[model samples]
Target: MAPALKRSYQFVVDNFLKLLLIPTALAISNKYEEIMHLCNSMHFTSLHLLCASFLIIYALTLLLVSRPRPVYLVDYALFKPPRSYRVSFAGFMEHARMGRLFSEPKSVHFMMKILERSGLGEETCLPPALHYIPPTLTMAMAREEAELVIFSAMDSLFSKTGIKPKQIDILVLNCSLFSPTPSLTASVINKYKIRSNIKSFNLSGMGCSAGLISVDLARDLLQRHHNSYAVVISTEILTPNSYLGKERAMLLPNCLFRMGAAAVLLSNRSSDRRRAKYRLSHVVRTHKGADDKSYGCVSQEEDDEGNVGIKLNIDLMAVAGEALKSNITAIGPLVLPASEQLLFALSLIGRKLFNPKWKAYVPDFKEAFEHFCIHAGGRAVIDELQKNLRLTNEQVEASRMTLHRFGNTSSSSLWYELSYIESKGRMKKGDRVWQIAFGSGFKCNSAVWKCNRTIKPPAEGAWADCIDKYPVHIPEVVKL
Candidate 1:
């Protein structure tokens, strides 16, 4: 058994003996009282004996129910950049304009400045096919890109698992911006020819946090159905939605957003235990609606210029800080080490007595999580989150680099971050990872995954090849 498991087992064994002593001692004390009462009142022996037996059974039941059950992560997969793709901020800008806009001196200068700073400026660019198409065909291009990325990801993931698509019992797809006539889930079903009776769900408008929300939903289904597998696909459509013209707020999305997707397969069957990594540990969701002031912090809207865009307000960092505190408060009691919990409680008490407004210092999370996959919304957002969480540069590197390389893939960005870590060969057996994302509805969501075992890393998969020189320090802002 692993050292941690051994420790847990020892603790349980020690506690079990103590617990057993309590019932025996209580029963002895009660028996004396019963004996005295029986003699004085002439009560029947049968009634006293029955009452004692009931007490013992009830106490044992309580102990059994309170003991923890081990939950394991079965298997996981991620999609990222292929090795041949490298598009700098300048290159992306130049390509996105399709030569028409880049022909202008100002446009060329702006693209060059941005590219020089962006890490990708020095890297190789992707195939010509990945560049932006004409304005009239933007929608068509968006759909094609969406299909290409998603299918490629799913194919790779399924290949790794050796699980036939037809064998999957549940399918869940989340894409926040685009939902065509036949949803992406339907497309998957048709392409793979999954069973007609397969249960499926498509989530739209749930924003970036929707990936965890989908995992939460899938977990519930797995627990209820038993012995079943669920496949989840997450992606975002970036072509038609690309913002053009000079609206600063509208330009933000164009600057940060990128193309990517991820496919994950989850199963509860005990037979397939060895292949899984990062058993689902916990999930927490917090939502503050649009009416809330914090809603504007990260929401998308049309500016006074009549251009539609997403606004990355400053207040979002503060709001996310508070939401994280609440989430940690709830999750801590469940997973925090005993020593940390005691310290945290003491700190809480000290704050209440000495400084009522004082924010309690959260425990060092580096002790708990080996990897952190924060959403790659933008450079500023990634920087703020790292400082707020007290994360190391390396800890936030994957998120920063993912944004720098692929831009924001919306709900699926977390997967790309995970891919970055994997591509670097950083993951190992029993490593714990945390994924946090903030999205529309002013929502902040988190998922904790603990790897079951190390497996072969996927090459020629998603972003694996492009990550070595990523996270270019781009200064010039280029519209997508």
Candidate 2:
């Protein structure tokens, strides 16, 4: 159909109920005198009261039907790679040296400096492709990495939740750098033999905050499809994204990112509430893509050498800060206590009217949430957030530790942080968790979750083997 015709059709579909109401309203108007006369007759008084009761019932039914469905986080799983894939700082540097991608001593030295300070521990795993001397960035290798991470998490999630693949009504899969033919979502459906009619979405190039973006999408879908289940798979295919260039800006991603993925099950089913871990409370995403600096702060492009990589601009931290401020400003009223909101409002007014230079009041988010899963982007990312949010060591502990254990897993890092909180037995009934992530679009997205019940330490997970060793002392600088 033509654009104008399609829009006209859509407009009619949207207003179908209103169109029906309009005809009913006109009929009621035409019969007003007859209705008034019938009301005066004794037998018609009972019928008038019956019609008024029916109208009241109809209005109540409309309200119930229009209300949004509550979205529940039924369960989630995080992928844990085998121990053989673990790469130490020395191991990573040696592999880079052997790859001959960096023939210059200065390039190798720069990577060393980044690795030492990247907040990644020696145990973080990389895909087999990256472990190669001249890393195999083949399409097949990338698919293998995706399947390894995504399917592992999915298997665990399905096993734990006992939710069959056929039961899922929606599927959302996100991989920032690796969108292939037979998209990842399509691969998942084929592998699991999910129903052909499943509403599926494949998201690419969204960056580290894309996981929450998936959650936001799934929540909206669940609200529309009542009693439905949605599964979100989040991961970064490190095999292909591994920068093999000499540019310092481009190489930062190689030294920081590692293997990780998460599968999350979301549902609007009232019966699933008893087993659900948390309920989605709010999701606020702020995008600064309109601004050139924000849009280009993190990008995937070919460098002067014609070698493609994800570049990190010097202004990334500053860009992220601005995006974060905008996101929090929008979400504060929804999540913060009334007292905090009032104080924030007063401070804004004071700053505008009286003193522009006065330090902006930062509301104590500690009072608002019991836990925080700040994205484990890197050491600098975590440090800046801790300092800016005025978060305690314990509040940022999960994030810091996740970065150490898994390195920067892109969007999946937030889920790893939340898993850390659960593994440490920090999650409790009624406790609220704030998950904040910054991504390539210079977007800062936040998801707030309210714990549905007391959470115990996991029997086995990414953190199961190493949870006790965390909150480890991370030096400001490490000497190799």
Candidate 3:
């Protein structure tokens, strides 16, 4: 028996005997009282009382043993990809030209010419008004860009799911940097004309990992309500916060962030299982805040050159590895097969006993997951996670391609990766997918999904038409 089961069994056994003895002793005392009162024969009365006591104790024990155990179950899966998707090169160049980041109008013209040569210019879907701004006025023009991108993404996701806004029981929105006065959730509710009874929550500043965190919250709500559906929208805004100055700390965002968003529908109604792609399996969250070294590894700061920049330290991969280790340690025992667990345990013991300084044994993640979605925070983050998890190039390609095509959409990045998989027609029934994300609270959160059926990729989906030319092998730049 497992240790926990054994302990519970021992506890019940010990308590059962004590409970039985209590009634028997009470019966004997009652018999003594009857004898003194001359109400009945002591032996007969004692036997009668003892028999009744045994029945009561037996019934109580049965009740204790029959209580139900808590089981986490998922019943519906509705995936949403953004409606309007734009490439980073187009978005960034527009921002640069308007913000006057380039001194000469010729530089803006040259960049656009290069994009046209690269076959990307024909692909841009930005508004015409955005293109007429001079290089010096880009910052002002970017004010509503994030909102436009988010609305487009949400509109697509909601429409594809065929979920009427009025039918949604709960709404959750996560945007790390932008939480407007009316709030994004309010905007969604207004746009959809959702029912007034719908519960809504808006999460801000939770960082990229907040996407999974929101999913976790939605799962809890579904489990409690059983038949209700929850809508989760994840996106990042880009307008007023656009940095036009030469601050390196701010410059990283300019290069790294692009417009994207995703919506997901979750439910606990068993009737919806046939249409769902995956069932929620498990969610694990771990925060490593006290470790200052890891916290600062990928943070935004001002460089010596006075440029606001996001520093991608060489050691961030190592930091992410540590976070993944902590997450796996908590998650492995729950999902890993017994044979794999045994091997992992033995490997761990051998490493500790033979060489304390030896690196911890990393499990073969392929044994645990059929597909993997590591957050596309950056190229280096993805590469490091691939190495640490021992994942194949194919498994990591979905993330890399999403990053290459969309940049970091913060919390919404994972959905793009999933969209990539769907667009390629790679998801299969019974496959297991794992999503791991790292973010600002120095938080690492993961979710596991078990595919319920083979899903046909969406026709007008975010990556549906563009996945054929992806999985680009962008070589890592080696700094001298």
Candidate 4:
């Protein structure tokens, strides 16, 4: 009986222990699963918050560093004189004061021979103010020239752009030879009655390259002031600047330097992109004024008789060569593609470290620009540039034709060249055009522009009436 009781108690104890172990094991497993689920949910939430924070920072950075608006050339107009102002080469010499001076006949003849190679046509126009006796250089005559040429160009441009005077926020006027007390800027402001608070700049004595300098200035100003309009006037008052001295160098400007002016409008407003003609891509300026030879290469001075005129250094060509080399060096890196730049870098390295006689490569600018508007300073200038740049005849045709028609209208000549190109319908969308200028400050300036729209044949422009007759055979000399 005792053995049976002991065995039954042991069995009951074993069953109780087994029941407790089963329930506790189930509870432990359930607790472990809850803890793992809570950890996974927290980890996922943290990951999602981190992704949101990264996106917010990137969006804020973009908002803080907004892109700047591009500067564009809305449109432009150039002045054309009346028919009475047109003078043939013979007609010019027949009216010269030199014919009366017995001592000057030889010098005048020599100068005429030089003019034969000047690349000027018979149709070049002189200012009406210069028709007077003693060549009318008075302030009143100067005012007349400016009113006729500058005002006509500006007025026409205003009409074309349909822009009111009040709309112009910035005004830049450049007249190298004739700067008055009120300044050309004030004169423009006064004529148009522009706003009193307009930003006005008058650049004087900078010579033919002043036009591009003015453009560069306007571009910078537009970049700073959002959605603005600027008007730039480029002209040379030929009436007061004509040199009547016996010195041949001083007399060169008389054979050239015709009456012309150009008015350009630029904008930085986003809405203007549709109407704009060109977007200014780059402006590179280089000055060699530190070199005494270059500084004096082109200068204005008084002769022994007290008549003021510009004197060209006999070494002007050399100075121009050096200046151009420097200018293109700086400009190459800006406009050149990565491949060209790398090659140029390699060539320099080769010359510096390996071989002293390694030829420094001349970049082919034609690859970067479809059209080139070299300054119409003279035939020699054109020829030299053509040779130096290895440009084809067609590439320099616009410049030559502009010189033949306008006879070096000083700072405004480049616009006439561009107008010639546009009138021919050669300028297409995305085509790049280059304008290179040389000035009295011993400066070489370049501006690159990309056409925004396909250019059509202009209805009325500087080249409108006679563009068809041009690209004609120009002789080395037109006999009197």
Candidate 5:
């Protein structure tokens, strides 16, 4: 069979149950008149009416009981560090030189080049421990950074939502590289004095996309338990994970990743809907870990001198492309309109059946979402996604601006992008948002949200101080 025939056949096979429903409905419609006549002839007695009512109620109860619970976003908070923490490019270089981590001049030059091309602006901040000469990487210092970043965001979140720690029934936190003993979740519980019985989870080594994974997990927990609230914190602690290795691939992270954290509150209580910011619509995740190339594309490994750092494989972009292709394919049907879906399918089948030169249709995601929070990982990642998705600069303004102002903050970066959009007062009730992120597991994750209410510019947030200055022009490369 031709490739088109095979794909068509597989589509049918995959959606057999849905296809079966159409014919079954048609057959029922053909017998509709007969069924109505039979019902009219049999329902004359009071006992019969009572039996019919009971059956109807039983079916309705089953339907209600089987459906998943709705999840609401109560509120969220982004860490706003002190102005004293901000680090300029010159200050960063001076600190690096003071640390004397790079033995060779070429390595220093490589780092400077990476910094120039990196999308980060002059105001991005680093942890206090990193400011000292021969920067401190002690476990104690790492804990201090973690506490400050996590607690600041959480405190703001609790205050904004007006919810006490005792109200939280579930806690989920993710920090990709830092998972000390007693766990980050335990730290939150201790600080907040949460209930002893709260279900808590701490996920580490999940990489930049871990924020959505935490959200997905919290949603699942909310659905299982009624009238409960869950708190999810996403952050990256740089003190322990900062690469001191002179390897160029390993050094790229030092130039990009910065200190940041975000906290989000999720609730399943029906009464909370009136005050919620957004409603969770969909969560789709795609993992390409089955392929060896994809599995090893981004990983933390020890170099020749036993220095640990996250290495970016040369094939990282190609692997990310494959993961994104798989992810969009899964999410397209869930979010795209029926007309767009039909056009995309027909276009693909046509190319396979007729001319291979025919351009394949890329469904217009703008039709589904009013806002896009593409993870602010780096300049190249954002550029490629914008070109492929055919998004206008205005649509991607939040992502680009977040990258410039906050740097690549790993798992928490998506929240910063969302905050940027909110800061610009672009979020209106009923509008939809799509958040996309990539991670070291060579995974692509997407979350769709519908605004529950019109959002005003925040009085305090990561963007509150400088949002007016942004949508700044960032050149392809800085000549520095």
Candidate 6:
């Protein structure tokens, strides 16, 4: 047979029984006596063989499709700041230039207050620029910071996975604030000497959710390019993009955003299944950029004094809530259990038909996922998500601890939270993890991962030092 005809024959041989079995079973009620009589008269077991064959085919096909060779997360690496980089609340106040810029006595006091109650631990690291005589945002400083973070994470990731830079077929790097002249993609390739033809991308201005976006992008590419490996690097360069202004909104990013990065390796090859740590199950990204409220909520621009800073609007939480609602709505059908789906549908119907204003039900996501990594942007962001999702303190512990220890690592925060969970031995084979992030553009994106094998905490991960002491109490108000 010709190649096309052979393929058609094989497809029919595989699926024709699956198609024929259901209607045959359904027809049994009307034709039961006739079929039995015909079978007995003909002294033929064709009917019995057909029924048995259909059963076998149906079961095999179900199993085959259910267990697709999903994209595998071979391994990941996180950038852990050294002890010298670690800072206390007092150190941040003295070095961050925020205190010097806000020389007025009252303004300084307010800034100190915000840092104290920011839910960040004393160990969060500031960038090298902040330690200078006068805080620097020079291009050289940005390059140094970018190189330190990106190289560190990638080196560790390559070492752990035993995958060389030349082996990577696709590279996606995300840095929200820093977009240099040569571009980060060129920098990474030139340094590593990757093959000239390797596909590469340097994504800027994606904010905290850029990591998920990178994963989504990689997943799509892997689907088109078989047996390919993709590397995603998520980092934020704080030196040049550091907000130096004293505006409360601008200053918030300074206290919250920290220096960190993560490198993840994803492979669609069948050989990767045995060694891979997690399988990529689902990725849902929702953009509210078209809406004025979500679009203007988190924006990076210069202030009246020509000081460049990211201005976080007061309605950020509300905007985030709206974005999250849209995200879960799209993802719920895929992950939610039948019971939760049915309840949500009934409640939605009731509100539309009866009350017309009844509070719509929020499907319990805890039922869908074994672990949750909510965005670790800030205390307010985590607190609001916890309340909105009705999550327990334990459920949000990883997120809160990631924020406290690493502060807001931008696109890398969710990975830090996932590391926290793994460090505590919370991840198990077949377990599902939900990672959700909110970034600038008021975007909320989620990626679902299923543990492919027993996950062991990496000895050199960011949480290796303090994972045991997390979930600590934080006072509503603290004085630095």
Best by lDDT: 5
Looking at model 6, report the run of 10 residues with the lowest lDDT sum: 95-104
Tens-digit per-residue lDDT, 1-480, candidate 5: 476984676577557789899999999999999999998987589987799899999999999999999999999998977778898989888777767776567777888898899978888999988887778999999999999999999999988999999999999999999989999999999998999999999999998999999999999999899999999999999998888888888989999999899999999999999999999999999988899999999999999989999999999888888898899999999998665687789999999999999988888888779999999999989988998889999998998888888899999999999998899999999999999999997899999999999999988878887988988999878766
- Give Cα distance to truth, residue 299, candidate 1, Å: 3.2
lDDT of each residue in 221-308, candidate 2, tens digit only:
8888888999999999988877777899998988888999999999999999989999999999999999999999999999887899
CA lDDT, every model vs. true structure: 0.71, 0.90, 0.69, 0.87, 0.91, 0.86
| Stretches of model 2 off by over 4 angstroms after superposition | 1-60
What tens-digit string does per-residue lDDT give for candidate 3 at 1-480?
A: 486984565455436767688999989897986657675444467788899899999999998656422222222222232324343564646566665454446545554543433312223233223234432234334435545655666566566567666888989888876666787788788877899988899998778899999998887776666468888888766554444445433355555666667777787666777777678888999888789877776665565545343555656667777888899898888777554566678778988789777766666668678899989887767877888788888999888888766667788888888878877888898889999999875788999988888867766666756777776655443111
Q: Kindly indicate the candidate among 4 and 6 with the higher lDDT.
A: 4
Per-residue lDDT tens digits for candidate 6, residues 1-480, read: 476984565456446678789888889978999988987896658798899899999999999766645799998999998888887887766654344665556545666778878888888997778776467779998899899999999988988999888999999999988999899988999999999989898889988999999999999888777789999999999898776666777777777888899999999999999999999999999999999988999998888889899999999988999999999999999998665676689899999889988989888888789899987988998898999888999999999888888899999998899999999888999999999999888799999999998787667678877777877887877676
Give per-model TM-scores: 0.77, 0.88, 0.73, 0.87, 0.91, 0.87
Which residue pairs show backbone clashes in model 5? none
Comparison by lDDT, 3 against 5, better one = 5
Tens digits of per-residue lDDT for model 1 on 315-388?
76677776666667777766666545666787899898888787776765776789999988766667777887
Candidate 4: tens digits of C-alpha lDDT, residues 162-197: 999999999999999898887878888889899999
* Winner on TM-score (2 vs 4): 2
Report lDDT (Cα) of residue 44, candidate 2: 53
lDDT against true structure, model 5? 0.91
Comparison by lDDT, 1 against 4, better one: 4
Candidate 1 local accuracy as lDDT? 0.71
Where is model 1 more than 4 Å wrong at Cα?
A: 1-86, 95-138, 304-306, 357-359, 456-460, 463-480
